[model samples]
Target: MSSKLEQKIAEFRITFIAEFNDKLAVLTKLWSNARTSQSLEAVKKFRFEVHSLKGSSGALNFLTLSNRLGIIEEKIAPCEEQINSLKTVIPFIDRHMNSMNEASRNTPNSLLVLQEAASLLGELRDPQKNKEEITPQSYRDIKIALIDDNENTSAVNAKLLAGFGFTINQFNSIEQLEKVLQKNTYNLVLIDTDNSTNPSEKMFAFAVKLRTFDTDVFILSSSSSFENRLSAVRSKVNEYLLKPVNITTLVSKIRKNFKIDLIRPYRILLLDDQALVGSFYKTLLEDEHVEVLAISKADAIMTELESFHPDVFLLDMHMPNISGLEVARLLRQQAKYDYVPIIFLTSDDNIKTKLEVLECGADDVISKSTPPNIIVQQVDSRIQRGQEIRYLASRDSLTGVLNHGQIMDAAAHSLRLSKRQEKPAVVVMIDLDHFKGVNDKYGHLGGDKVLVSLGQLLLQSVRDTDYVGRYGGEEFMVVFSNATPRVIESKMNNILTAFLHINYTVDKQSFNCSFSAGLASSTDHEKLSELISSADAALYQAKDAGRSQICVDVLNK
Candidate 1:
């Protein structure tokens, strides 16, 4: 593998150095056009050559020649003010090309040219290079407590939440829950109640006590009377869910309240009119584990680009019919891709043209002759930062997971692809049983720890191709591409078990938690909303059937 990579690198280096003189000749011709007609296109074309040669020359240890070429790149910058400067610089470029070619292959006659280029660089690059500045920038398992005097309900709820990426513990009494709270924390707590006209004093007292711990407390009653509601408020209960609970509503609340930062694979779009060059570059990038879509034509790219949805655009600075500048402008005009970064791999060195490209909505520009290592680093760093920016804007801050809108957007995208490919897709809706009880007993801070924990767990546990996001409160949505119900069921089981075993602590006290999940596949519903609704319905079934389990919509049907 190492040898193969080395061989590829060696061949790439040679190819990287190919067409040097030919490019230099092109630069000379463009220089003439720029000098005579003051043509910006000529300078734009000129950069395609000199900028590449500049890097190649520098890479081969020819500093003076490279720097000299660099000067011409700046001179031909597509600016009206600098267009006239080309005439004077043309002679400079001419003499250096001659001097560079005349020099012995082994020893460069660079001492004089190097000094002159150094002087030119000092005048050109100072106080004007500010392109790579991005202003600064995980999910954890959620722990929950289901406090119900009824063993059946509490146990079932605990297991239900556990299946969905929450760690839940069932306590039959507030006293039992208090002992766990003393040492362990929970993000939510659920107190089960009956439809009696008068509130149970003991249950109300426990709810108030749990509030002191800063946990989110909820009372689940079989009644929704005003008196019952007022009693909950007076008891300091955080929320009141009428039984039988709509599991989807409860899960949505959880998702909205908690956060998780999920990871998804990012890809790049490479636009180079040169098919061979684009192919080789694509291969090089792929070897580094970068996903890239390389295109040689500027026409008919919008649709492909829309579907590809690249994180970064790698473009050749100039093309024949439609220049890179025009393409960049077109991309900027679209709201959908406004945040994606555009980087030009060009031979143009004109400071003006660089600024022009920037104005066209590009992120950065690099010479094509840059070392592969540096180029790779450049692409990687930009992708990382661009993704960070993109995700931050759409994710829940604490958990770093997609928020409702973002997750739904992901769902819509998946639906489109799955429908097109005629492949299966799945949506899993998860909820924690008696979640408010966990929050109430553990206090808000402890509750937060649980949410963060659950968020991190889903992100780390799921496949890179999967999408994890908080649908609301403690409820989460996971969308799997090209996956069957069986696949989802197996995946959910592992996540549930993992949550069930996570030991949580508050003030050195320890406890555990669990969750429940409901999964629906594309076979059940073709529309995005219908699919989610189906999964949500299945979630209710899981809770009804007893928590800490997963319910499949198709299987039930």
Candidate 2:
């Protein structure tokens, strides 16, 4: 992230906070009137405000505040909805109120709950207040506790998850887990419920207890009954997965749940025969948070190109043997590098030489004699504008992931690279389970929110090198480069576990929806088209077997 861009987002936060406070004041006034008079109109108006606040706060990532507001919203009186009694909602309004004028607002029943909720909103928004809550999660350093009576399953899952950069500890019972959790903190816990005949019952009873320790608890059980699933929800379980779970799916779920905001710096590959000139330029760009790899020899270009993956290339127009023009032409020959911005650094200001440089496929020709700060500004602006253009052209308008055509292009490029590297590339085809029902129940707007959340989760769960693209409505595609077939399938399941936990609200009612994914890898197929077809076929298998599950390509498995 650039300093300017960060500043702009900060400005947006300021505006949002100001607007939020103003609305909150109005909401409080409405609540006070409703609590005193029990007026139906005031009750309806204040309830709408609560709904709006909950939605907006969650949308802006003020999760702690939004969740509290959600709990308060759910307390809306049923009698008031039926117009049976206006007095029914007074208790709720009083309990959730934060009245500045009323001294007795903090009664035993009221508890200043709304006051705390409001304070939490400001705390989450301020970086200095409870900084850890607002900071990017340390995904790599995630610690997990797994409780499974089956020691074999625990050992196997623990080893696999630990191999993929996680600290996983296995406990045979809730008693053992509880003892360890007293002294050590974990990000999440996996409960395999097989101790009793009812599978999830005993472990499900422990979920609320585990959550009290400030750790997310996920239940893995063989029971797929609706009652048991509902029980898991009531227990405040983060996710409920079926038994015979895919190890990779669990890995992906944990990973996606612990998403981090990784800001990638602009990369500039500078080639200048003069050591002093190259070093000077590198230092200037580095100061601006740009990654600069200065190479004197043109032969080193190919070696560094694969690793550095520069966003912009700065080539000396006059090199020892090869000029910038020749290098630009060579790079332009590759289809993938066609969009990579190349600038020529020249000592000569001759119009003919500049024209020649542009003719050879460089985006622009800049004189080496130009001011250093000016050069930095020019390079930075070009990279920003080019990214903006690419974003507009290739991203899905609604979800902001890569559009259909761009994803296809990415898949093609990914396959070619995977083949060259002698590594497998995996493709996962995802579709929201029973999405039409969501549209029917909550309307299309609600359905769109689900898709947007899914798209964001898909992008966040993977590395920057991976590709996430919107296939169409309620459908998506993700491509993982240099992935193993079975291994990638596990990673592909990350979004599935994460998505189901996303609660969507409509008209004060909240619900969560899950997605099914089909994962196929280059282990069995070579062509991109074939790989995608297999993945699509596997996706249908998942949908057929049961929704909210991931199916791996049969051949690859």
Candidate 3:
């Protein structure tokens, strides 16, 4: 097995041991209560606890513990009638607890006992019977609006979008599009500035108007004039496509902007002993589209952290055995969990107490009596801020694409994933044609504008699964997932042609620029370094052939 797989198994073992200890503790308490009071309620509680433990143990592959719990459960299956007989099962429960404690300590004898116990339990039931089935969610209908003066163009665009399960409404003019926007909301709006009869300023104004409604807007234009591109930026256009847009690229952009391909549910871990209070908090957060896992046992923290990987931890100020502060300190000691957000939920409103909680490694402390809405807002804000900080760290300062080191790291990771999954990927290296002329003639500011435009273009042009990065000054690298050589060549060609239309003005004179690109796919090489070297060789070939063209690396086997 690979080291990665071995590490994952080790992590699972740690979590399982912790959770088993917690379950054992709970069972011990319930067993003691049942022994003292031979009532039907006590018997029912004991049986239920044993049944839960049996299920958890089996799932975690602790067959010995599971089998022992199963025997105890079977002894109490008669319910109230077996209440008085439950005392006879106390020895078995105690033995199981002892075994679990030894297992937690990684004792060889306990491990041998567990293996023997598992062999005995093999006759009870199929171990795989408890595996859960996962069902895929159905896709929702997406509504899109297309605005263009040309009927043919609008119809073609609408038809293509419709094929992707989008309900498209085509408008022949900006006036018609505006009228529909007022009455209905759309997931996306595609405007063709070149096909519009309205002037450039008027088209930009309409885009600005659409932004007010918080709808994702994409511009399809044949013109990439500096003025028009700058206007699109100011109008907050989500994507700008050069005229005669590539249908595949357009769909990819729409999916990315609307998060159609990203269904990331925010995961939250709630640590509280108060069952009722924990339920309330879970329900409130779930209503806001958050996935919450609540654990009353403080010892089970490691288990939930490993499984759920929560974005934020909602920890109670006080928990039995382990206080929230102590738990926070323990978590801080672990390198993997050092940066995770821990918000203390407490009823104590004393300022001194809140400060003390913060000192104990809490990111924030909130009163339990605070309104649910405010609590949700605080949690959501903190998660969002954390995401933004992470995003900024990985991105280039000027272009918002991945920085040089990040891009290389991303490429290496992607290559490993592709190799494991047996999927194909393409790497395209791009260099601006006559970029030094732009800097020398139009000045460095003009060059910066060109770089920013290309950055935005690359970002908007690729699929969400693809990675775009600023490799260096005027060079960019794009890693396209699950793409073939043909696809990479076609896409890069489209981008190159579109780039030529981007006009920049210096003084009263206007100029345009283009880019040369080289493509290398998974078929060409297995290693990321080899792929990059192949693409770089191709890029040099493109530069030698002409300044504005794309060359595919043909590796001789």
How does each model score on TM-score?
Answer: 0.58, 0.50, 0.46
Q: Per-residue alpha-carbon lDDT of model 2 for 1-557, expressed as tens digits?
A: 23443444344435445555555678778777777766667666666666556544443334555565666566654535764455665565566554422423334332222333233233323443211221235435788888887888888777656544468888888888778777998889988886643345667777888778878888888879899889989999878889888654565455435533323567899987665456656765775666899998888898677646677888877665566788889999986676778887654446887889878888887665454445666887777665555555777765667899889988887887778778888999999989999999988756766776777677778887888999888899999988876777677666677776777766656899998999898778878889999999999999999788889989887
Show model 2 residue runs off by greater than 4 Å: 1-263, 273-280, 295-308, 320-322, 329-339, 358-361
Inter-residue clash pairs, candidate 3: 221-243
Better of 1 and 3 by TM-score: 1
TM-score between candidate 1 and the true structure: 0.58
Model 3: residues >4 Å from true position, as ranges?
A: 1-372
Which candidate leads the pack in TM-score? 1
lDDT of each: 0.70, 0.71, 0.70
Model with the higher lDDT, candidate 1 or 3: 3
- Using TM-score as the measure, what is the rank order of every candidate, best first? 1, 2, 3
Scored against the true structure, residue 381 in model 1 reaches a CA lDDT of 87
Error of 2 at 478 (Å): 0.9
Angstrom error at residue 240, model 1: 39
Per-residue C-alpha lDDT of model 1 across residues 1-557, encoded as one tens digit per residue: 13454455445435544544445456557666765676777666666666555644543334666666776666555354566666666676667656655542333332332333333223222343333332211113556788677766666666545544567778766777777778998767877876333347777877787777867787888878887788789987777888887543465445543423323345889888766567656765776665789998888678675357688999877676678899988988976577788899876656987999878889998876565556767988888777757765777765557888888988888888888778878999988767787788866545655676777688877776678888999898999988999878988999999988877765545667677899988876768989988899899989988899998995534
Model 2 lDDT, full chain set: 0.71
